[model samples]
Target: MERIASVDEIPTKGVLFDYKEGPFDEQGILVRTRDGFKAFKNECRHLPMRLDDREPADIWDPHGRYLVCNSHGARYRPDDGLCVSGPCEGSHLKELPVVVKGDEVYLETDKIGGFFNV
Candidate 1:
């Protein structure tokens, strides 16, 4: 059930896709890091707000290490899915398991909530 995307479809940094239905109500930003492709639920743990409120852009930190919630200054490390700051310090970015097959990227839709405790 992984949603596949071509390498061209995804930017070198990352791309945001809106997930209005299915398991995720909010959008998810997929990043192409040194490790591999990764995605996270695009909502801030604090105040239950969308992370990209003002800019409506994909959530990404200047350092490229974490996706940032600019609204409340929350930072989520893309590597291990940890919130390093803000009210949701102990919380983590909802991880979306993904795989890159050849030039396509797919998300494991079946295990969305169950695996990540979403």
Candidate 2:
């Protein structure tokens, strides 16, 4: 497990974190919802590209209800990483396992083997 962030560090806009998958460096997004904290790969379902590829850190829609892929306008649910609209509708974002321990969030790197095809 790798410590990613503290619970208090996650904002309404969410937090972007970096981790390693084998020798490759990858990014994940950590979000806090009504249910609890959720984490997902920064890649969009429609394509193997970062959701904020076009606009740095501009991952959320104007209303902040959904996470928007700036390149393709795909909107994903913050709580479940489900693409509800746009080209990737019916698809879900690749989720990264995360556990909150004593106010710190840890990425379950062991569970991520081969998931990212890296």
| Candidate 1 lDDT over residue span 3-118, tens digit each | 64687888666777655334546667787767887887777778777788867455777766677887878888777668998778979877777788887877776666432222
* Minimal lDDT window, size 10, model 2: 109-118
- Mind giving the per-residue lDDT tens digits that candidate 2 earns over 43-97? 9989999998896558988898999999979999998999999998999999889
Top candidate (lDDT): 2
What is the Cα root-mean-square deviation between model 2 and the actual structure?
Answer: 3.3
* Model 1: lDDT to the true structure: 0.71
Cα shift from native, residue 37, model 1 (Å): 1.2
